[model samples]
Target: MMKRNRSCVLALCVAAALGTASLGGCSVGEALHEGVTAVAESASKAARFDVSGTIEQTTMLDNDVLTVVAESLEYRNDVAYLKLSLTNNTEGTIDVTACTGGYDANYVNDCMLSEGYFSCEIPAGETAEDEVDFSLQELQLYGIQKISVLGLGLRVVDEEYDELFKDMVEVKTLLYGSEGVDSSTFAGSIDSPALAEKLEYEFKAASTTAPDLAETDIEIPAAFLFINKDGDIAVMAELRNNTEETLRVQAGNITINGLAAYEGESWSGGTVAAGKRGVMSLRLSSVVEYGDLLFDSSKAAEDADSTEGKEGVDLSNVKEIGMTISTKDANGNTISDPVDVAFAF
Candidate 1:
């Protein structure tokens, strides 16, 4: 009976051993499968955030203008290093989840994600740091010509995380051109009044004309007579040759009106040469006060009709005057038609 019991015990022990070996082999296979899956998942995650380090050889186009260029970008393996310095200029503590940065041509609405680019989250009134690395192959496939750094994304834990970060926060992207040089910074606000003032000044300066002299001779008619706002009257009875050489004169006379207080004070002096006409300013000492000056067109017409022997003529009623100038050749012969000047007060 003892021998039979020993044989049975040995058989039972062998069966138990075989069962244990089979279980161990199955466990090993399961572990190997799990290990492979974990490795693959880790590789995928690494590829997603592969953007690391700095972009090199960047070029900036039209520094002050809207155009910018990037020559080259550099990265550490497949990882990108991003540093953000944020300041809360607002009154309240602002929580930010993510920020975006990229090339904006219009700088208004057109912003696109660059290669291997993504958004992150930041806390209100607190600075946050993030490290990202993406797949090299994916980065090239995205055709990312520029970069935009963004914040706020689907939270890893819960959907409520979306409201944690608001888009009110400002982001200043310090981009280095392909040459590894810093580009100009741009602000997002607009000051319309200031811009308008600058534009006004630019137009004013452009409209002001400089004095120019005529390159040819000019002539004047005998009927040309002028009275200025200052009450000064000038009558050209004959041609006055002030130059030594015989030169042609273009017809024109400068006059001033001294009687009309609102006309202000003006004067002009220059020599008319044989083949050149001099330009002079008819400036007013002060701008005429509005509503203080009166003009009489009837008196001007009367004066225009008769020049007989009028001296110290009362021109207070004169609202307008006419003067004519005709250019003459070297021999004092009239050239082209006469140019007329009409003055109104």
Candidate 2:
């Protein structure tokens, strides 16, 4: 009797699976398909951190030559990623130096020496897809409502445009900063109003008002020298810690005489032991046509020697080196007020 009961049960299960009975009436193929589909849907949901509804498209122009379009910015695994594309319409390449990525208005960059992105080239008459990545795990931990990426400048490398000011190739910035249009020798005209506007922007930024570091506790115990040696110009200074505690001095967004001396890199800055001193310097390199100068201190140590007490350092018609050096604490939080130390030349 028991064997008869077991045989009846087995027959009923086979009938249901074969779709011959009303008990859930599913075929073997149908059951297999449904099970696989359910598993796939769950795995698909688990794979992605959804930002489909969060991203927005943005368009930015780089000196009227290159167009940068950014979209689908998302963060995962401590890296903030952006889908960016560049279309270069002009006849030259665009030297994109940096892309300032921030959360809300907060610049996630702790030390001003953030190389947002560099050495990335966009050739003319070409469209290229670029991926920009930034590490922002701390920002995520603190929480973020929005993400913004800006502060991008492109150096247009065109032979035609460069030829327009061949006479000013070496001393263009020095001339412009010292004499502006009055020094008509280097201030040649560009037919493109857009290019003119961009030049004007750079000029204004590089030669802004001199900073007043008097309000801050930081001090430069020695006179800073703008030196010329080995075909390189460098600024050497001593960062003196006036505070009772140690200081991690950070200098970024550096500009000199209305031009970018150094951006996206620390300029003449470092840590000073409690009431002690540290070396701060910036070694500069750039095309002079842009009517500005920049300083890179992170690499200044390599070029620091042979510049000490160097008599050949030129200071003619000099103005100021606009910079902001901040003092950071043990937790990397900015503990003191920003030190706007625009060393006058």
Q: lDDT of all predictions, in order shown?
A: 0.25, 0.37
Q: Lowest-lDDT window of 10 residues in candidate 2? A: 164-173
Candidate 1 per-residue lDDT, tens place, 2-33, comes to 00011111111121222211111111122222
Candidate 2, after superposition: displacement of residue 168 in Å? 25
Candidate 2 residue spans exceeding 4 A from truth = 1-53, 99-115, 138-154, 159-345
Candidate number of the best TM-score: 2
Q: In model 2, state the lDDT of residue 193.
A: 29
TM-score for candidate 2: 0.31
Model 2 C-alpha lDDT per residue in residues 1-345, reported as the tens digit of each score:
000011111112222222222332212222212211111111221112122223456665543566667655666664556566767677776544342221101122111112234334567788777655544421221122123222232333454434111000000111122222121111121112232232121111122233555444566644332221112233444445566765566676665554444554244344444554444545433212122333343334344354531222122333556667666653356765655556554
